[model samples]
Target: MQLPLIDLVVFFVYLLGIILFGVSFSFKGRTSNDFQTGGGRLPAWALGMSIFATYVSSISFLALPGNAYQSNWNVFVFGISIPIAAYMAVRYFVPLYRSLRSESAYFYLEERFGPWARTYASVCYLLTQLARMGAIMYLLALPMHALLGWDVGLIIVVTGVSVILYSMLGGIEAVVWTDAVQAVLLIAGAIACIVVIFVSMPEGPAQVFSIAMENQKFSLGSMDLDFTTSTFWMVLVYGLFINLQNFGVDQSYVQRYVSARTDAEAKKSTLLGSLLYIPVSFLFLFIGTALYSFYQANPENLPAELQLSGNADKVFPHFIASELPLGLTGLLIASVFAAGMSTVSTSINSSATLLLSDHYQRYINPQISEKQSLRFLRIASLTMGGLSVLVGLAFNGVSSALEAWWALSSIFSGGILGLFFLGLILNKTKKPNVIPAMIVGVLAIAWVSLSPVLFSEGSIFRSQLHTNMTIVVGTMTIFLLGFLFTWLVQKENGKPIKSSSD
Candidate 1:
């Protein structure tokens, strides 16, 4: 169903408000430092909200619900892993990053190993952010296409340009503040959907639960130890690794780490951001369960198109377009965009920051003026946003957005977390040892991630492990092999094995 005139007005107003909110702070990017870190004066609450919004990407808004609708709450186990990761990040990474005077997350990598180490990790981070931006943009286009009946590619291009303009003009301050607003919208919108679902139930809210229980919609997948499938344990392991990677090594996250006014503030922000996802994830997943219940009780209500497996991602959006009242529908749609915009904005800004701090200043011109650096950053943001548009268009017919994104993330992440672990926990990381380790890890990662696609069905040579294991295998291969290689080198040179403090 197309949005009514009032709903269209509401949606456009919400978009305009977000754009204006960002553009209002455009002057903050006058200097490279202001653009990158908001002069290091942002409050903890805002940063925390921004971080929270970043975590609830369009994947969470749309793809996650789709997963819950089509399957079960298996991936919800992923949220169960966040607190542990948050604690680790707050305990080690916050203080470590706050101590650094550099804006780039990979600066420590360069300090520990060399420029080569920094470049390698930076490249991995940039690639991951691009893929991240692309996926988020693609998911962002879904609701737009559903509501306006616009071509998905056209929606992507238009939405990408809007985000590029916002990120380019406003930088990190805009990102943080806009993110805080979007975070509220995300939660509000999700709660609204849950409430609507419950209110619409024929037998009441309790009926939704009874129906879900009857259907086993709330199961967290089988209690099996099989790594070949995405069982609870496998998903937990994947979540642990992926969350560790996000909190430990991701530039978009670490950039927020350094933007805080104090160590306590940063730590507080990390806890707030990470723990908040647990309940919010429950909401998104339950929306799916509730949706299933709603449909089961009134099977005639569910359209035949949404009944198809691939269209699971469109279930929540279809509900918004068809079931909700006009004004609320617009609000909910805007909320979905909030999820996408916050993430894409953060990615564009952080990617630009990396270009300036990690590459341009570090390599091309160390003595570049503040004005020149700001110009470089703006241009870089636009360029990265454009590249992501191309990739978003590439994801035209993906079966499952969340599943596809997790696989792509693991591949693009390329075991950078493992390399970071080696540098942080082990002293005197050798370039030679790390190089060989990275090569082996990348090969392992490639084999695990691609074999399923490259090989035919029932091929003996295919990877038996689930796609989520791509990060697990890649990270372990790099760290374990790098550790072994490093130890052998140090022992051969008559040196003692050292610890993190050494």
Candidate 2:
């Protein structure tokens, strides 16, 4: 099913609007401060929307529906933990970052521990963002390839280049405003798909619900307490830790905090963004449930390739291409790109900010002019964007985009949150103890993340610990070990442990 002429027009027009809107902001900010933090003049509501859009990502737009379609709604438990994370961010992280008034989130680590801690965390963040950008690009291209039979590489190049151009030109203001628009488009797209599913059903939404219930597609995952399997508890715990990193420590959200007008505004933005995410996520998950019901009732309507392959990810795109009215299909497709672009643009901007603020300015050249700093920022953004495209194109043979991303995220996060916890809660943790604790934390996380592969079948160390527990375990390991080491050092030197206030 090819897109009609009208749909093509709609799709291209949406892309053009995003590009032009983003580029429009490029002219407003000539200095590094203006570009990096929007000069602290952005509105809370708009920044909130931008944060929501950035967090959702193409992975949520595409993979989340597939998650619900293929299995049960247990994964939705992840949303329940988001508010808690946001509360922590609003109460602690937001005020801390606002008070510091640093362009990079890692700057606090330097003040708390040393430059080494800041550098290590920034590197981990950069690596994770690069992988994320690639994954997003790959997910965005999937529908394009399916709809137009276009080569995946070509789609990646075209979309990636567009995002890079606008992100580099517009800086933070453009990214935030365009993200607000994209967030609306994302919600609209999901709602449109739900409506289409309901209308297409002979029995309507009631029947759709009945079928979903009958198929157990509405199950909230397994209620078992087992940690080895992806039970409800496992996912809930994982979501809590992951969301903590996202809200409390991730450069993306931290950058948004810096962009807001005040600490109160920043806190409001964090809460609003995260609170809205709960319902919006359910909307996407419901689409998957509705899709499952719609297709089961009308198996004949399922795409032939999807039917044979049984790929849940293809189901949404297949429906859009085959059944949607001309203009609507394009709108939905553009929404997918919107989801991808919001996150990718943020990653490029945030990663570039970290490179310049945490490294270049801190170490190599502290007295660089605004013009030179802005130049470096743009160059760094372009470079990271290009590398992400290559990484996105290289993704192949992944069974589930959602699972793949979670696994990758766990590996790259490397318990940096533990370092933050240590700094905030333990006064005795000095600079000397920071590096050792981080080293132990990374190794512990690596063991948890890679043990299954490294130990193989029938090995003692290859215990049945779930991947969801990796961050939690890793964080604790770092904090405890770091604390103990600091205590030992203080005691040996005949000195008392000092509190964080000291």
Candidate 3:
């Protein structure tokens, strides 16, 4: 079904508004520092909102509800770990970065370990963000395809181009401010869906809850301790480790931290973003349960494709297209676009920041002029955006969007969290030993992350380990082996391992 004329107007107006709003910030920053970090003058709340928006991509918008609709609330175990990760970030990581006054999050790695460590971490970050941007774009295209009957490729290209243009022209300030807007729209959109679901039901909210409970949709998670399955323990552990990566090591959040006006503001932003995520995530999950109840109560309202495919992911989008009144559909669709644009813009800007700060500036042109650097930043932003589009196109036939994204993220995180753990926990570890430690860390993570894809179903590694355990195993392996290797090197040289300062 096509959107009504009014709905089309609303959607187009929203796209136009984003472009205009982003472009307004283009002339606001003149230098590379201003472009990359917003001259370190962004407000706390705005940064917090941007951080939240950046994390809540269209994948969460679509997949979370689908996840809840199909299964229990086990996946929300991931959000439970965010607070713990955010606390650690505010207490240690934020202060460390602010004190260093570095543009790149990986700069501290170079200081504590070596240049190679910084490069490796940055490369991992680039790969992770590319995968992230691609997944989000592809997910966004699904709803658009459903709504307009347009080609998914066309949708992806149009959305990708729009985001790249805005991000490339306006820089981080534009990205951050636009994200603040997108965040509000996304939350409002989710709330709107919930309200519609309740109102549309014959017996209302209580009926929805009763039905969900009867169906066991509210179950938090499984209590099994099995490592080979997605038990509560497995997801909880995975969530903790992955959240650590998000708060401690992800360039996206780290960039937000550095963009804050002060160290205290940065910490505040982290806490605020993390706290906000829990309720918002719950809202999305609730929408899923409510959706299940809503559709069950009125099977006639469900889409034919969803009915045929039994794919829960399409249910929400189908509802928006077939059920909601005209203008409201457009608004919700705009919100979906908002969710996607906020994340992709951040990815483009931050990836470019990493390329310029970590690589180009470090190696090719340490003393490049401001004009030249700004030019390069724009070029890099556009290039990354294009590459991400290609990546999105490449991932056309995934079995499950959310699961595939999580697996890709685990692979690319590369256990850099372990490297940070080493720097923070063992102050006396020698810098020179970090190279071998990182090598071992990468190899171990690769083994765990790739075993399922590379090995047969009956292979020992594939049969024994759950995918969620990859990060936990990879992180621990890196921290322990890195520390041990440092010790061994120190013993062989007959010298005490010196502190980072030494």
Candidate 4:
């Protein structure tokens, strides 16, 4: 593939923009708090954009559109459920968590539960983030590889280290502000790609919809309520619960709330993030369905490899590589890079915070001063960044990335959410029962998630679930079981129980 002058210009601009944003923050970082939570100085809008950008990753950029092309537009409805989850987060979770005044989300777990529970929850978060970062790297690299013949391995390393360099230097301050910029770029790039495709296609939007409807592909379900399908109900339920886990317990998001100057600001950010997702997702999926029409009209123009994949995930890059005008291709490709960089930088920095606050400062160096803690923060950043790079290298393909992420996420999320729900919504158990309940909850979810048959379409019990919803269900089941067992054991011991909210 010969490079065009316009494409090169767009690519350079994208790379330069992120590097510059990161450099700007380096000079402003003064203390560990400044590094970790922007010295708690951010306003609602900036935090909202950070939350939106952080939540929408390369996975959605590629997978959701590809899913719309392949599975139908039923998945788009998940966007509707997100705002509802966001509402709950703002109304209940963020305000309550802000009152606790902890940098690491798991630190609150320690206060309400115990050391063992905190460690368990944090480790789960750490592992899930590692897999997620790897997946993001892998997805972003795919477009570059197809369009520019860039080595995927080298691209992953360059992206990983570049993100680490800036994130380590600027911390949350850099991640949040740069993510706001990336969110705009990401949306602009997607819209640009759609506009270009529409102009090049033989028919207009009406004709495109006609083709989609002819194939019965523009929908949520095939009008079947069969348990053997990833239906709309399954997606909605899964989305609602998965989001609950995210807003309720995920440390990465919780850290953002703590970064806000006021509890009200944090809640406002949460609300804004939820409201924005609906339009953002609708646009992305609309572009995807449009791309499907373009390909149907000109199948011969697509790359040989893409046609062979029989999956539309590869189509976005294929269109960019083969059909788009020169400069626009560069812009869209840059968008892909922005997606990967924004997500990896945020995850690395957030995980570093978890390591230092939840792990090192608590267990390894209890008497450390602020200056000494800053030193450890830098060290944790380097170590976690390196580990994520290695994980990215190990990701052979996108499917592996998805599996690794889901498996790691399920491990701790169920237990953490369960423990929190116990704390916030139930008043049945003493603190002493927390560790035991968390242990059981974690193990139970891990078992269900890892079992090959659990997510299989043929499974009688598990086949009815979507991946995200299944994890949420597993998490909830553990939470309830843990609550019951804690209630029983505390009563047997004649111990006065404290509510999870206490």
- Provide TM-scores for the models: 0.96, 0.96, 0.96, 0.92
| lDDT digits (tens) for residues 1-502 of candidate 1 | 5679898888899998999889889854367898999888889999999989988888788878888988899999999999889988998888889998788989988887789889888888888888888888887887778778889999899778878888999889999999999999889989999899989999999999998888788899999889999899999999999899888888888999899998899898888888899999999998988888988888888899789877887888888888887699989988988888999999999999999989999999999998899999999999999999998998879876555776677777868888888877785444437788988999999889889889987899889998888999999999999889888988999986676787
lDDT of each: 0.87, 0.87, 0.87, 0.77
Query: After superposing candidate 1, which stretches have Cα over 4 Å from the reference?
Result: 397-405, 428-432
lDDT (tens digit, per residue) of candidate 3 on 379-399: 999999999999888777877
Candidate 3: count of backbone clashes, pairs at least 3 residues apart or interchain: 0
lDDT over C-alpha atoms for residue 67 of model 4: 74
Task: Give the clashing residue pairs of candidate 2, or none.
Answer: 74-220, 74-221, 427-500
Query: Candidate 2 overall Cα lDDT vs. reference?
Result: 0.87
Among all candidates shown, the one with the greatest TM-score: 1
Q: For residues 1-502, could you state the per-residue lDDT of candidate 4 as single tens digits?
A: 6679889888987787788788678786468888788889998898888888888888888777777676578887677688788878888888877887878887766776778778888887888888888778876777677778889898888888888888888778888988888889888988887777777777665777888888876787644554335677767777787788777778778888999989889988887766777788887787778877778888888667766655578877777777778787888887778778877888888888888888888888888888887777777888888888888888865456676777676664556677777666554443635555556656667656665545565665443344455466566766677667776877788875566456
How many residue pairs collide in each prediction? 0, 3, 0, 4
Weakest lDDT window of 10 consecutive positions for candidate 3: 426-435
* lDDT, model 2, position 400: 60
How much is 224 displaced in model 1, in angstroms? 1.1
The deviation in Å at residue 196 for candidate 1 is 1.2
In model 2, the runs with Cα more than 4 Å from the true position are 308-310, 396-405, 428-432, 494-502
Which pairs clash (backbone N, Cα, C closer than 3 Å) in model 4?
74-220, 238-469, 423-500, 423-501
